[model samples]
Target: MPQQSAEALTSQQKTTSRRPAGTLYRGREGMWSWVLHRITGVAIFFFLLVHILDTALVRVSPEAYNAVIESYKTPIMGLGEAALVAAIVFHAFNGLRIILIDFWNAKYQKVMFYVVIGLWVVTMLGFLPRHLYNVFNN
Candidate 1:
């Protein structure tokens, strides 16, 4: 038998005292924001892979790139284009907020989060109408 130090005992107690994983979900705003940040990050990674492939098409031939561009001109694809832009915008702003919280004293993190959200909304409102107009008008 080995003697466990007080620090080790306290750490073990903390780990075992937690609720089960399934029951741990509190559904708070911060939790939701964290989850969304991760989801958007993965989506952006996959989109980047596809974007790189499409960009490579231009090296193959102008016709190859033009074909890809022409396919993206559909109204349905336009909606997706708008969503892609939105995800990019949200991900970038949220990433900055995360960096600020991680590096700075961020005492008012919840209020800062609301500010991030407000900025996101304003950015979307400013861009979406113009994007949608370009989408349908083309």
Candidate 2:
């Protein structure tokens, strides 16, 4: 067996160390997009579940349903609703990015991720002001 020279070993280690572990997306935009997608997905799911349960309260007791609905009118709940909308917007746009990756073989995944984020920001910007005004004023 031949022993590698110190310079050869050092150069090899430097190159290999610079390479990230795991997949191409291990710590990049793709990884964050994937993580945010799953998180927002679960958040949306739980929000929907809570919404359904609260709506179902109407069948059990109209007064209880009204009370619950009224409680959601607070500023805190308004902020929470904003977060929900943000999550929904991100999830929806990211879903489209995933579809493009799968069907269109999108090579510019990082670009697509940025596009999704930009779209989400634009959408939220359009929505938040009026919604916040209505929530805080009424």
Candidate 3:
């Protein structure tokens, strides 16, 4: 068997590493939406875990629970809560879009994806005003 020359090995490595990632991610909306969907899902899961633990604190003591809940009423926390609602909205609608693509029809994926985004936007617009009003007014 012949050993490969250093120059030959280096040339092969250059060719192989040229494609760090293929045309798979050419700024397509669908690809980005899928990525965001996964991110929001993971975030929601962690938030739910913390939320459950906080709710269970009522069992420990109602004052502690109220304290924790009250702590979430500040401007920063209100903004955080708004972002949470946005994440929840996006994740929920995207999940339904995914279901339609997987079970109902795959051909209308692009259109459905846009529809999902529109619905998410409408939902956020409807909720954001009320949520901010309550948060700020309280």
**Which candidate achieves the best TM-score against the true structure?**
2
Q: What is the C-alpha local distance difference test score of each model?
A: 0.84, 0.92, 0.87
Model 3 CA deviation exceeding 4 Å by range: 1-27
lDDT of 1 at 28: 53
What residue pairs clash in candidate 1, if any at all?
Answer: none
Candidate 2 per-residue lDDT, tens place, 8-77, comes to: 8888998877746655555588889999999999999999999999999999999999999999989999
Clashing pairs in 3: none
TM-score for each candidate, following the candidate numbering = 0.75, 0.84, 0.74
Q: TM-score: which is higher, 1 or 3?
A: 1
Q: Would you list the rank order by TM-score, best first?
A: 2, 1, 3
Better of 1 and 3 by lDDT: 3
Q: Please report the candidate that would top lDDT against the real structure.
A: 2
Tens digits of per-residue lDDT, candidate 3, 1-138, equal 135687788889988666335555654667877998999999899999999999999999999999999898797899889999999999999998888788988778778888988998999999999989988898
lDDT of predicted model 1: 0.84
What TM-score quantifies how close candidate 1 is to the native fold?
0.75
